[model samples]
Target chain A: GDSVTQTEGLVTLTEGLPVMLNCTYQSTYSPFLFWYVQHLNEAPKLLLKSFTDNKRPEHQGFHATLHKSSSSFHLQKSSAQLSDSALYYCALSGEGSNAKLTFGKGTKLSVKS
Target chain B: NAGVIQTPRHKVTGKGQEATLWCEPISGHSAVFWYRQTIVQGLEFLTYFRNQAPIDDSGMPKERFSAQMPNQSHSTLKIQSTQPQDSAVYLCASSRGHERLFFGHGTKLSVL
Candidate 1:
């Protein structure tokens, strides 16, 4: 079985501060990790994704690196903004099954001015 | 493109009633997934389809839950004799050739 764990249930930071949301996964096959963000009333959208490339996927100033050795893909941002306030989910998909994603419980981020 | 379309954005049903949720995947995507979201459980994978065939339904409950994708364009998740515990936001997502999923706004199901 595959699973994802996000340690932070909630993270709050002031505007312009750094942001980091922890994500770790357990899988038996080569993992494809992803970061998704959901706005207040919008659907969850892909924030970034990682394959074997080790390219450090980035989108909307947020980035995440898949460390297969560590089995982690922590989401990070150099500077936070009000628009970044949302629910962030870390997911993983791989072989042996349908290749469907297994998502973490999610981390709610609140940014203040 | 309309990423993924899930209909009846909100649904309320009496206990023991039947509820059917619809999902329209992207035009050319081959994979469709169904998930349930709630306050306690953030997101739980329910089932998925690939190429109009149910490749994995291990996440789905055997008795009351069933899913079907008769064609490439649409899929449905049905719950029979729904219980109040079934209340949650049901989400449908699709992907083309990769794992980056595009999700719908989701259907909010409330069983009372």
Candidate 2:
């Protein structure tokens, strides 16, 4: 069985501060990792996805590097904005059209001005 | 293009009653997924369908939960004898093969 773990349940920071959300996964087969963001009262949207070529994926000033060796795809931002406050989820899928996703508990990020 | 569409943005059911949630996947997508979101559990995968066939439903509850995909365009999740513990947001998602999933706004099910 595959699973995803997010270490932080809540993260609070002021605007302009750097932010990081830790994500790690375990799987028997090769994994495709994803980052999703959900704003208040809105559905989750794909933020970024891992590439087999090892290129870092980034969106909206947030970036993540997939480290197969460590089974980690940590989300990072050099500076946080108030709008960045939301729930972030890390998910993993194996190889197949019917492959199901295993999602983390999610990290609630709160950015203040 | 419209992403995934889920009917009944909100549903309130009494104990012992039945509830049905509908989902319309994005046109041209062959895979559909159902997930449950709760304050305590976060997001949990319930089931999945591919090419209008049930692929995996190991996450679904054995007795009261059931899902069906009779056509490529629509799927349904039915819960019988609903209980308070079943209250949660039911999210529907669709994707082309194994690509990034597009989620619907979700049906907020409140079992009273």
Model 1 segments beyond 4 Å from truth?
none
Model 2 pairs in collision: none
Could you tell me which 10 consecutive residues in candidate 1 chain A have the lowest summed lDDT? A92-101
- Residue A76's lDDT within candidate 2 is 97
- In candidate 2, how many Å is residue A69 off? 1.9
> Could you report the Cα RMSD, in angstroms, for every candidate shown?
1.2, 1.0
Candidate 2 structure quality by residue, lDDT tens digits, B1-112:
8889999999999999999999999999988999999877889999999998999998899999999999999999999999999999999999887888899999999999
lDDT of model 1, residue A60: 86
Clash count, predicted structure 1: 0
User: Highest DockQ, which number?
Assistant: 2
Give the true-structure RMSD of model 2.
Answer: 1.0
